[model samples]
Target: MLSLYRAGYSPWHRLAAGPKALLLIVIVLGVSLLPVSWPGPAVAAAIAVGCYAVPGIGLRELRRQLVAVRWAIGVTAAGQLVFLGPGPAAANTTRVGAALVISALLALTTPVGALLDALERGLKPLDHLGVDRQRVALLLIVTITMLPVLARLAHDVREAQRARGAPPGLRHFAMPFLVVALKHADALGDALTARGVR
Candidate 1:
């Protein structure tokens, strides 16, 4: 479920992990910091969608990223719509979409080992402060991989509800999701501890 790397012969796949990760952060931040107007964020998102045309990435990867983040996009849009009005919601929604696409693009192009190595190298400055760079890097990578799993869990829970003829609402959804999420957290914690992480 956490496999994000696709073997490819493209330049993106060949690029060193440090630069690739940095570019991912820069592009996402640049999109987010754009003026809180429709065209800015929307256009950024459109360009992000267009990134699928790059040599290694394809329509299939794009759709997977969309599927993985669909519920999140929906919830973010709805929350903003109810609280902040359509303008902000529209901007934030597109921004979120663009960011996810870009992040997923990194995962699709770069291998997990490459990313973890890059993260450890980048965090070396903190080693002098008693930071365990390997553990920290692994933690960061796990977080990146976990996002899609969480989204998938939400989708499965929703589908299960529909299959069982349960009502479609958060009230009915929250408890089950919470329980499963907690169990997930507990398992992750146990795994980390077993690996000698404090």
Candidate 2:
């Protein structure tokens, strides 16, 4: 299976996945809630981008992450710029971009297995509510784990389009991307069923 877990001996890598995930969420949320026109999120975005300096993560990973979300950032900034003006555009774009970067950063520092374990642990108590906690955890963790995979697929699809000299458009991009995504989903479903994850 394709996994994003980078093997690292850094302290960041050693931190417990649950707490690290929580802290990242809190930071992103906190940044997002900053008042309109505030410069805080811009600063947060810069720091979040620089956080690629985490021991095992380097400029290459940072570049890949930024590239992965460039379209999202661009569209967000453009919309905000058009409607809300430059201040909100800067604030919102930074908030959103930093949130994604932090998410990718967590994937870089923690193993997908660890995230699954943490989710399982956190969701166990919900078993009494008649929820299939195992499947819930698996679903949540798998979605989180697929971020990098989706990013890679998008990159590959773009490269394939370029190689074929197909002009880039949302329809052309979405067609192939959705088809490839569904194929991956089918394979993942088969694997999970084989492993009794269903």
Q: Report the number of clashing residue pairs per model.
A: 0, 0
Q: Which candidate's TM-score is highest?
A: 2
lDDT values, one for every candidate: 0.83, 0.81
Worst 10 residues of 2 by lDDT: 34-43
Please write out the lDDT profile of model 2 over residues 1-198, one tens digit for every residue: 467778887666888999988888887787677665656776776667667776677768778788888988999999999999998788888888887887776777888788878888888899899998778878887887787788888889989999999998888999999999899899988989898875
- lDDT score, candidate 2, position 49: 63
| Off by more than 4 A, model 2 | 161-175
lDDT (Cα, tens digit) per residue for candidate 1, span 1-198: 255688997777888999988887888888878777757987777778777767777767788788888878999999999999999888988888888888787777888888889999999999899999999999898888888767767777889999999999999999998887788788878877997888
Question: Which candidate's lDDT is highest?
Answer: 1
Off by over 4 Å in 1: 152-198
Alpha-carbon error at 9 in model 1, in Å? 2.3
